[model samples]
Target: MGTDETTGAEPRATLEGFLRARRDRVRPEDVGLPGSGRRRVPGLRREEVAILAGVSTDYYMRLEQGRERNPSPQVLDALARALLLDGEATDHLHRLALAGGRRSRGAARPERVNPHLLRLLDRWSDTPAFVLGGTLDVVARNRLAAALHADFTVTDNLARMTFLDPAARGFHRDWDRSAAAVVAELHKAAGARADDPRLSALVGELSLRSTDFRTLWARHDVRGKSGGAKRLHHSAVGPLDLHYESFTVNNADGHGQQLVVYQAEPGSPSEEALALLGSLHTLYPENGPEAGAGTRTGRA
Candidate 1:
């Protein structure tokens, strides 16, 4: 790769800094490596790391210095083991590798909302529901999600539109909780991909647009959003209270992608309200995606 000597802010430098910092924090005493003499550097040397990680000393040195950014999965795994990384830290290593300004292998396609999943969504056509990705992208939605959150997809990103969209101002009954959830999810994603360009780009956009997102991001909250509830205001359907559940379908093909679905409690007013919404979908099937047809996704 040709070096752009004039570029002052390089992403690899940030990745290099992270790698070196992680290297410096641990000593030979920590992982049973031999420390023969008093060390001059703060952390293990290039050769020490290489030995522990089962890599060539020269290659390890090049990686730490940001000269070789594309380390294979096996190599990364070995390095993580050598570094004694926990689960979260290991995930962060991948994120850092992706974010280190290196183009990664293309991501698997956005999951298709399968017929079974769509049928499940269809079963609750009255419920205000949608599916969200880890990055807060609106992957799928029922009619109610669209009616209540009209500008949600048009704004391109869920987190951005949630905090910055004018429609969202009154749509979400609880802004603080909603904001926290979004930021928390972002925090968790960032840890996994400290170097992901797309994620970094989204965070940068949110930081510029919404102070609330920036503040929450600084808190370093990690959230694996399995489920939650929200009260929504729809111009057509009025107000409806609903609870949602998220399931991460095991995409053997993809890294970490999840599909979220929502439901209303049985026998409650929301449930009754949801029933009414289901009726509308059956009668007015032409309103949603594929015009009364639902997309199926995942094995579930």
Candidate 2:
């Protein structure tokens, strides 16, 4: 019942919040349960979920109220099945259950990109690559990556850029999909780091500023960053269809870092545009069209 210092608001318990939001998404028909006409709430009732999970209604109610902690693996599995969660969402549910009300003790150390990774990024002159910290902060980027994101006013955090920057709507061709994916990634991060102050602050800022962010966040979607195709409209290069692969950087310190690289199909128009962009970057290293125009400092 403690208040969140970061947001100065009463914070919802992680497990309870997740359970409620997810429960609201599942319809009675989703689990082969016949519809009981005219329910006040969306999705299945607590009794319905308990029935599906093979647990007592009281126990399930306690679980949703944050009074019941330390659910066994068997119970967790049953709940996952009852909720019809996918692999990622199931894993996230387990993580939240295992967290056991942990809280952040102090400020986290600033994230730094590995020197070898930086060298690798620089070597891929034709590709766009960048390193992202746990909270999707762009810790480091190669010249090509910088050029790829030249339209962004703040290139620090992907979530911030997607939700807070005006250029994002134009830059991301599928704005709705991009926005949902960004929020879903953040949702996954929040499950792992429930009490992380920086993350809480970021979520609070986005929730306050963007209606779209609030709507997506409320869905409680969980997804990790992985290989995917992106359709982007660059200010200089027009539309560019690219595939990106994300690799985890296994640092000695065990910090969460991901190296993301973007590539275009060979002989495609996107590839030609990318090559043109690289040439432009090389021609004007500091003050050319590739330069990050209207760049501004962002929150760490």
Q: How many steric overlaps are in each model, in order?
A: 10, 0
Residues 1-300 of candidate 1 have per-residue lDDT tens digits of: 112233311212144554666687678888897767878987687788899999999998888778987888888889878877666656666766766555554333444444555566555555555555546665566665555455343434567777777777577778788888887677666555554556656676666666676656544445667777887765555676877777775642343555566667788877776666555554442224532222222210
TM-score of 2: 0.90
**Model 1 misses residue 91 by how many Å?**
7.2
Q: In candidate 1, how many Å is residue 238 off?
A: 3.8
In candidate 2, what are the lDDT values of residues 1-300, reduced to their tens digit?
A: 444454443233277778888999999999998877889879989998999999999999998888987898889889889999999998888888876555555556666656676678778889988777777777777778888888888677899999999999999999999899988888888777776677777787787777788778878889999999999999999999999999989981444778889999999999999998998776423222211221224542
Q: List the residue pairs that clash in candidate 1.
A: 95-193, 99-195, 99-196, 113-295, 113-296, 113-297, 114-296, 114-297, 115-296, 126-278
